[model samples]
Target chain A: MILTAAFFSAAIVAGTPLLFATLGEIITEKAGNLNLGVEGMMLMGAVMGFMVGLKTNSPFLAILAAAVAGGAGAFIYAFLTVTLRANQVVSGLTLTIFGTGFSGFIGKGLVGEIMTVDIRKFFAPVEVPLLSKIPIVGQVFFHQDMFVYLGYILAVLLGIYMYKTSKGLNLTAVGENPAAADVASISVSMYKYLHILLGGALCGLGGAYLSLVYVPAWQENITAGRGWIAVALVIFATWNPYKALFGSYLFGGLDIIGFRIQGSGLAVNQYFINMLPYLVTIIVLVTISFRKSKKNSPPAGLSVPYFREER
Target chain B: MKKQLSFLLVAALILSLVLAGCGGNKPAETPAEKDMVVGFIYVGPIGDGGYTFAHNEGRLHLEQELGVKTLYKENVAEEDQEVMNAVADMIDQGATVVFATSFGHMDGLEKASKEYPEVAFMHCSGFKMTENMGNYFGRMYQARYLSGIVAGLKTETNNIGYVGAFEIPEVVRGLNAFTLGVKSVNPEAVVNFKTTQTWYDPATEKEAAKALLDAGADVIAQHQDTAGPQQAAEEAGAFSIGYNTDMKAAAPGAYMTAPIWNWGPYYVTQVQAVIDGTWKAESYWGGMADEIVALAPLTELAPAEAAELIEAAKAKFISGETDVFVGPINDNEGNLKIAEGQKLTDEEMLSMDWYVEGVKK
Candidate 1:
């Protein structure tokens, strides 16, 4: 039981960045925009965050810099997709390639540099007075980081805002049929821009989490495909923010399982174990695709480019 | 229609010329009249400014010092089938010798050697070799052992740490050699090991270094590509030994010396062999005596005794009077692998997978 609790704790910490990115992506997709530049935005955020944090020796400012950098990257996507009406898939892939090369160019010198400021982990467990006394359940719920608690709260709050509010209905309507929504006086372009930037900010924060709170130093290619995993989580969640939290934790658990198994001196192929999370992600995506239930799903006009004459 | 047909005909003629240029065709010449063309395939980009850079420098030396014509493909992914095609292309282009500077490139080189029996293939850090293919690796563990002596002398906490790239035998042997060298001087020292499962993850290497430092280690050594551990050591006010290249600038205050591979002499010799038609299939594992494996100059911050100890060890190794993996060694788990007063054979060292005593697994 203790070992399980330890594993869960490690999983939550590891999955925090993925959860943030997935949740933000869910919001962006909700407004009918598909942003494949999450990985690019994340890399930019990581480099900017580390540079700022190293210079200022302040973790808060570093995170803010990361968000700003991410926002800037998203603005590029918005200008191409929402304004110019360019192909979303092509733009996203181009963004990823450009971001990867740009980040490497910018971060070449910072590769081996020691981080000057130590960013205190934002997810340290908080012990509630009354909840601390319970046995297994209390230990699991009460002893988690502030970010974990905030993630759950945000998920529930966003779920309510999307399903129960008139503003959310307008947003969903715009996503489903931009021509109809424009006729109904809803600005589809505005929603698309807002959601894309929001997604970018979230991805930036996730990237910063890797350098600051997780590894706590600057490194090239530090994200290591976490951005792609975040995209996969969005699909596994069926475009719902609430389910994304669970999905991220499941992936995180698989990652830690490999390390734990290797640590225990268990006779297992580390390569196969290392590949477990990626393989499981593919399986989850396939299952989600096979299940045709549309309880909470992608926006109807997700990947289609909108033009004035499209109607 | 006649004018259009003429234009098409001209375009076809130009296209054929371009294709011929890409095909690397030249007028047939006698072997004695042609300059020996040697090709090199690097796993990483030359701009990496580290491992691949060192190899590129060696290739440059072959061109400048030996006057050998060299061609190279940088940033070639190890698993890409294009590597084999590239090798074949080099051979077609009149390369007499080809060097594959990556472990994963071995199978590709082996396959190419079987297809082209006339060309000599030399692979770095690979176990398998064919009649035309030979393996070449430096005695990096010798330098690691010497660096460990400096770590042991400098550490105030009696705890030394090693950040390894992978758990492969090459890295494993380095870790064991370093631990043994540290124990030689500081008998009470304990070496902690952490594997990041990658050759170039700066973030993980930094984190692993911090973890070791936090656990009471004061001297850190790494078997990784980047200088992350060195930077981490400088930040934490711990001493560090670098790998592959001179990384003193990365962590000036905390920098000790690094065990760097000098490939220039070997490159010159191999190219000379090809020119003289005396190139033979042989594994070359040279150390400081041959100047293949060398220790970088000790930093100003290094302990006063470091230079003296390193000099003694260098002399002993050069004189063939001392083997780094001598007897009275024990595995990390406390199993006596070598009896007292018995020296470890070269075959045993080649297949060594166990750690010596005083190392934490």
Candidate 2:
């Protein structure tokens, strides 16, 4: 029982950052842009968030600064793809390169610096008396940092906004066929820019989670490809926001299982156990790709640079 | 168009003037000029707060004490061509002495050293070297042995965990020495080893440390850079030994004194040699006597008796009265690799690949 509780706790904390990144990428992909630069963007966000959090000693302001930095980065993608009609894939790759180099250069001076934040001191967890006392499910669902609860709420809200509203339908139509949506008097470009910026902001928040709440200190390459895993989860979820929440938890479980297995003295090879999550990702991708039925593929016009030419 | 052209012309003239001013202040050369420009190429971001952090601290010491002009490129990937390109760029920018600070940077440094024979090349933790190239590393095993003395005496479970970075000789030697040191005191202690191929992945390092703790190990030690293992040990209520630097602050309750490499003194010596026009290529493997390898202060958690034993061992090592790997030492396979009353030759120690007795392979 204790071990199960420990596993669930580890899952929730480990999954928070991935949940943020996946949900952010899902929104961007729905806007007809596939940003391969999520890794780079998250790295920039991590560094900038650490710098701000360390300097200001305020987690809230650090997250805000990170969101702005992320939005600024997304704006570069917006200009290249929306304004200049550059290849979205190429532009996203270049953005990642720029972000990695820029972050490393700026992070050089932050080595060995200690960072402190008091989010829990400012706002404590609210326990629901009966709900908090249940079994494994209750502890997993009810007892978590504020960010874990927020991630679930964001997923539900995003799902409602993507599928249940007229504005959501219009956004979906634009992603499927921007030219047809534009003919119907919808501003396809405007929706694209809006969703892209929103996605960028969420990614930045995810980065702040690393420095402010997760590791809560400065370390280079700290994200450790969590951003890339988030991007992979976007595809694994078939671009659905709600599924991403569960997918993030599954990845988190796989990650923590290696340690759990090693702790048990099961005589398993640590290398094979360490490679479990990555191996599962490959298996998941293969299963999704080889399914016999027609399923949720990406939007038809996604990654196609929009121009106002003859239909 | 005319305004733009005139602006371009003025900008070009000003840029050249600034460049000339920056380069024109070289002091008048004596017949025997004694100045050196050193370059460093790093494999990871220097702000990793672990391995790279320690190396960068060494570089800074070189600058402050020896007054050498230091240039460095951070986050250079381990690809051979990319490393060569960075080395060539540094050489073009006037690097007289270059230090490639990773095992993967060895071949590129060797090739570049051959291409530019006049330049001195020092590769860290690398075995291959030429006339103008030398490998330099401290006897980290000596310090690890000292730390293990504390682990052996302090542990209640008689089980120790080792989170290793690679299967390379340097790491293997550290593990073997640590296990031997532990067994010297406890006799019944067993070391559980886990190797995570990379040197700086904190998530994996942390998990490895936790796994070791879970498997009933009461004390943990690591060869990786980050304090992940230390943090894991603290969380798991187990004691830990740290590497590269003093990590007592990271895990106040769990930290045992760590084996640390003090590169500052070596950096000061090497840079001074370069500046005095007396630099020569030679492998340097210093230990406690020279202060190249020293132990961090024991944390409050270490037992009083254990601390005493560690101090005694450290004193013996510092006074040149003890050798950690003397015969009759048996390898892991139960074969006697060194004869009774015999110390290993320098060449034998350099290429050591086998674990000593009581170390799990």
The candidate scoring highest on TM-score is 2
| Per-prediction DockQ | 0.17, 0.46
In angstroms, the error of model 2 at A96 is: 1.5
Alpha carbon lDDT of residue A81, candidate 2?
A: 87
By summed lDDT, the worst window of 10 consecutive residues in model 2 chain A runs over A117-126
For B1-67, candidate 1 gives per-residue lDDT tens digits of: 7568558757987998797667542333334446788889988755454688678878988889977
lDDT of 2 at A259: 53
User: For model 2 chain B, where is the 10-residue window of minimal lDDT?
Assistant: B24-33
**Model 2: DockQ against the native?**
0.46
Q: What is the per-residue lDDT of model 2 for residues B155-273, given as tens digits with 9 covering 90 to 100?
A: 89988989988878788888988998898898898888877767876666776776677667889999998877887787678999999888876677689888987887887777678
Q: What is the C-alpha RMSD of each candidate to the true structure, in Å?
A: 7.6, 5.0
For model 1, the docking class works out as: incorrect
Candidate 1 docks with a DockQ of 0.17
